[model samples]
Target: FNFLGYNVNVNSLLANPYCKYTECCNDDWIKFRRNRLMRNLTNHVYGQPLLQHAVDALTSHFNPNFQNHKALVLSFHGMTGTGKNYVSNFIADSLYINGVKSKYVHHFIGRLHFPDESKIPQYKEYLYNNLKAAIKDCPRQLFIFDEVDKTPPEVLNSIKPMVDYRDDVDGVNYSEAVFIFLSNIGADVIREHFHDLYFEKGRQREDLQMIDFEFLIQKGAFNEKGGLFHGDIIANSLIDHYIPFLPLQEEHVKKCILNEFQIRNVNLPKPEHVEHVLKFVEWGPDESLLFAKTGCKRLSSKVALLVDKYYRHESRIHNEL
Candidate 1:
């Protein structure tokens, strides 16, 4: 059965560790897991074979011992619009497909908070409540925390329990969960710091001065490889700055790539699809309708209602015709 774009092998992928989540049972979980894993592959850096190997390894490992590890923490750092969120979700989804439950995929980001100790308890309480809810559903799950570095130390500390010990709730140790932290910090900082090397190493042959991510980083901006910085320097800074976490090295990125290509089994859609959808959203039926929708004379909500009326009128006319 084809579930979530993955070829399902119910007897194989989900032979062990029965999934407790109802939505993720039999072949459905495997399908979801494959999709998630495939998405992470797109962020794979070039020349990093280990990254691909790692993804493959995970795919291979899931079938036999799917429920063994609590969580697979994937901590990656890069620039904005570099597919950080996408990759993290991809990993989460892939794991879901391999009999991993949807409850396991927890996508978290930092929320703005005032620097006040009084608010800490309230904040922590809220977090604890949510964590309790998540654990109750699926004890063994994966949590994907996006924008990890951008989060404050307090917030980071709050999550450390889950990532390190596999449980977030106080006095409870849930070792069946996995944590994956994705960030656009370390690699981004490195690229900005050592951008000169990309220019000096005969990398950008073009005359364009303001280097965007594409030119500097050959394999797109998000991957640790070809972003407006030297690879070696980025590697070194990653080693120094992120001592224990390991700032998603080239090999790690390779795993992301392999996961992307293998799991999806479908090439990434062309830019035209995105452009078409955006244009469709922007386009209006008539000139007056366009201006009305653009909020020239009313609030956006009012304009949306007007657009809906116009569309209804148009539909009536078409039906009559």
Candidate 2:
């Protein structure tokens, strides 16, 4: 895909992990940056508790023997369109702007096969060697596996050693990279499989919970003894989880918009522009085409075009009806 006419060879880049990471991984890609963090905190959409916990988790890694903490594993499981991706990006951006170096690696994990596994021992052998090298000089690295549930059992099993501490005789210092797993798995599914319940009713409150079903299954606890389910063990292995809710009042959204405009070096649009954009948002997928067309046009013009097109189309439809 060409990003603003920049010919991007995705396949070749993906093959080169380091190059792929550098190309796509940048703090600016996230909506919230250092310039916007403090302002965002006041207008935080998800409240402060979960965000604070994430900061604490990242900071704790600075301590010695932090490697023993089992790879700062965070599982973000929720319904679609719940800002899981946004919050993850925000966390990554925040750490980066603070001068914390982290190697961000995001993989879809569709089938979870080792990149090169023609020979049985070859893939595992390569992984072990790589892990050893990573340990030699711990560079802050984050391994993000998005849609972990989509990965095949074989691929998931391959990563097990990396997720936990393992002995390496000859290799690098110690693989001290953090592992982050993001999934759209239904909370009710996790609860039923682990907690042996039917559904996840609205709690009216946000507190993170991790129920261990896969652990029980591996330990031979099943049927009457315990909820021995082998379904998605990684979900059970959650080091941390957060439910991000948009608790922002109207004023908060306005503040965020203004802050975003300022940090982006773009002039804030008039009130009418904001109204037009909001209407376009309400229109959803239909307005997506407009954003795609506008590219880097002025925000004011984009909003005006969006409003004009929407009303024009609506008038036509009404006349036809």
Candidate 3:
């Protein structure tokens, strides 16, 4: 067989299974080497404590010396555009050499994949089969469930067995696999708690610790109306960590806008141009303390439009000159 201009023996390659797939692994490694997951994550606007905890968890999971390792189950709860999904993608990119595109990474969107509540049983079975197959193929598989708050309890519970620490399941070991759940189930509580601490209590955002917010978020998620309602996963302590994403303040949104400008290589005419661009974004319902309802989700397009307008005006001025 000729592959990439190299003449190879098909029979010999088949005889040596490891050699047959060496190219694939090497390619993945090359991709991984180019990714700066930790650096990129640190550059994000997440709190210092959250970033530290996440880094610790990921490092421990990647450490070969770590013993009695179960699958790292992380449940990210917070508001939309608060970086839950972004962080999940970062973890996926960090773990496998190919990042989110790696065969070992599996993403499931709750609303898109399991919308019908009546067919939860079917969804559960599908989730189980796909997860098992993925883990069977690669023990280090990463499973990300986005919008978990929208997923039915029954469907979410299907992976409890796999999330558990086990030597093997039906002769396949998945102890090294990772499960990440992204949700907005406890966003309001988290935001309110921070508001009280920052405003009423006169505490700095950094002073507001995880211990102060984790309990409230967890309680909200387990309530009847919450996503994990009546599920044994939380009660039985199946999840290892419940990371809360803080609501983005106006400053954070501005930073996000600047990041977008950098990504698109667009320069603003002035520093205040960021604020001007922000006017296009709708704020939260509260008229007093303004915050971006959708965080930086729509900031990119807004920035792009503003930059285009600036360039068009400049072009017209140059033509007149």
Give the per-residue lDDT digits (tens) of candidate 2, residues 1-321. Answer: 999989998876656466444533332322224435444444543322335444555556535555543556665554343345556666665545432234443434443544433543655455455554544434345556566555433444455655555443343322445566655444334323422221244332234332232333223311212111243334355343343222222333344444444433334445774554544222112532211111121334444454455445543554576
Top TM-score: which candidate number? Answer: 3
Candidate 1 — which residues are off by over 4 angstroms? 1-21, 24-70, 97-101, 112-118, 165-173, 192-321
Task: Estimate candidate 1's alpha-carbon lDDT, on a 0 to 1 scale.
Answer: 0.42
Better of 1 and 2 by TM-score: 2
lDDT of 3 by residue, 99-155 (tens): 788777788987899999899899999989998887766667778888777788888
Alpha-carbon error at 210 in model 3, in Å? 1.9
**Candidate 1 RMSD computed on C-alpha atoms after optimal superposition onto the true structure:** 13.7
Clashes of 2: 7
lDDT of 1 by residue, 1-321 (tens): 899899997876655545444454344453335444554454442222223433653554355556433333444444343344544555565656532236556656654431344576666666656766776666556665555444444544454445442334465555555555555445534344233334355443122222333233333222432221233322222211120111222333333333332233313423443232223232222442221112111122332343344344553554576
Instruction: Tell me the lDDT of model 3 at 255.
Output: 80
CA displacement after TM-score superposition, residue 57 of candidate 3 (Å)? 1.2
Better of 1 and 2 by lDDT: 2
Provide the overall lDDT of each model, using Cα atoms, as 2-decimal numbers: 0.42, 0.43, 0.74
* Model 1's TM-score against the true structure: 0.46
